[model samples]
Target: MPGSVIGINMNYGYPGQASRHGDEVSRTRPVATTSEKIMFGAPVVQNTDGSVKAWEAASTAANFAGVAMRKVKAAKIYPYQNFGYYGAGEPCDVLLRGGISVVCAWGTPTIGGTVYVRTNVAEEGSPEEAKIGDFGAEDESGNCIALTNAKWSSSKDERNVAELTILTRQGV
Candidate 1:
């Protein structure tokens, strides 16, 4: 007798992907000239002039705009190329209020748990040091700050990606 083989589906969705449709509200904003590369699903804040930049500190949490959304680009020849990020001066679609998939940089995600963004305080020599835009469930060594109106919609999957639902933003 011949052995049978089974196939498995390993399709974890990409970051910044909206879990559902209709209720999502997104706005196009220009990436600030001084902003770093804004990855899809990274938390961002708006400059006084309305340009968007990656979240850098707790003080700017009040200016929290939302997560950078991933838009399909014709130049990306492969599905996994670049891991999806927008360069300075690019037009970025930001999800203001909705369920979005994001990368969990540290800590485990649980449904209904508060969403925290890693700030610049993450220890300079730690793995999270360069994870400024990633999400977490707790303030790791005071390096993360909670997004007041956002929560985890789903636990992180094998790909370290989870669904986050932003209910409201301060100025959105």
Candidate 2:
């Protein structure tokens, strides 16, 4: 399933306690109508007008927004205002941190492995096998963008899905 398939406790924090379970750590922003297919935990970047899109290596730190919180359509208006609409784009709630995201596994992600967004090129040892959006113990290529908060409790298969927490919004 896509990361957009959220649990009932939508705003719950990672390893969230029952007392503060309902608190929202996410923020809402408009997404570009031409934005890429952003899954629940995918990284995104922002435009000068505050419209968000998927994070790419070409973007700088200032363009980095946060993670997608829902499966939003392009050009659909949200309840708040005429903020998101066709040509105007759609609004997507973003989870800056303290939220769980189901991301793709580049390799077997360990409990304490570091999460990174893969570039167009493959990893050093994993030739012909792409390692984009993969979590690993080391970053050899220097092309990996770190998602500092994410961690996996169990190992995941390559190209499989696993849930992780958004610990911080440190863009690299």
Candidate 3:
């Protein structure tokens, strides 16, 4: 999540696929709206020696949100809204994921709240694609939270443990 992905999105920015409020075309931008949401920008490419080097997006996509475009950020979010989907549903809970540090309070997560976590995300879109967005409300109170406090276990201790684990539906 520290780095950025730049590429042409197949879901959006096309002729035949151009339709307002349509999922047929996805948008391409710095994907940050959805937690754990991963999107690969165009492959990084190398120009020297005809090698493909990594390249980030040279431009930004515009959201058609009725709200003042001023509020629309140069970010990866819904096409027509100020706040992008919290992605606080189903598998996208950032706190309960395995790598999240146990310090986070996972019980009773509100609609759009962030719980302190220490989980390592996948290379780019691996975990995001696997993380099915959710749209339910939970109360993060005195409950048995599923904080998989597993320290970084990658060969480089990269904290990729959560990548291999599929989070349960929901828990505190």
Question: If scored against the real structure, what TM-score would every candidate get?
Answer: 0.84, 0.58, 0.15
Give the lDDT of residue 45 in candidate 3: 16
TM-score of candidate 1 relative to the true fold: 0.84
Candidate 3 global TM-score: 0.15
In candidate 3, what are the lDDT values of residues 22-102, reduced to their tens digit?
Answer: 212121222232224221211111222322212122211111100100122345554633223222121111221222211
lDDT of 1: 0.78
Q: For model 1, which pairs clash?
A: none
Minimal lDDT window, size 10, model 2: 12-21
lDDT of candidate 2 over 18-39, digit per residue (tens): 1112433666677687776444
* lDDT: worst 10-residue window of model 1: 3-12
Going through the candidates in order, what is the number of backbone clashes in each?
0, 5, 22
Candidate 2 collision pairs: 75-85, 75-86, 118-132, 118-133, 149-167
Q: Rank by lDDT, descending?
A: 1, 2, 3
Please tell me which predicted candidate would have the highest lDDT against the true structure: 1
* Top TM-score prediction, candidate number: 1
Q: Output candidate 1 Cα RMSD.
A: 3.3
For model 1, how does the per-residue alpha-carbon lDDT over 56-154 read when each residue is reduced to its tens digit?
765445777888888886554466643678889999889999888888877788889988877765346446345666688766666667788888988
What order do candidates take by TM-score, descending? Answer: 1, 2, 3
RMSD to the hidden true structure, all candidates: 3.3, 8.6, 20.4
CA lDDT scores, all candidates in order: 0.78, 0.51, 0.20
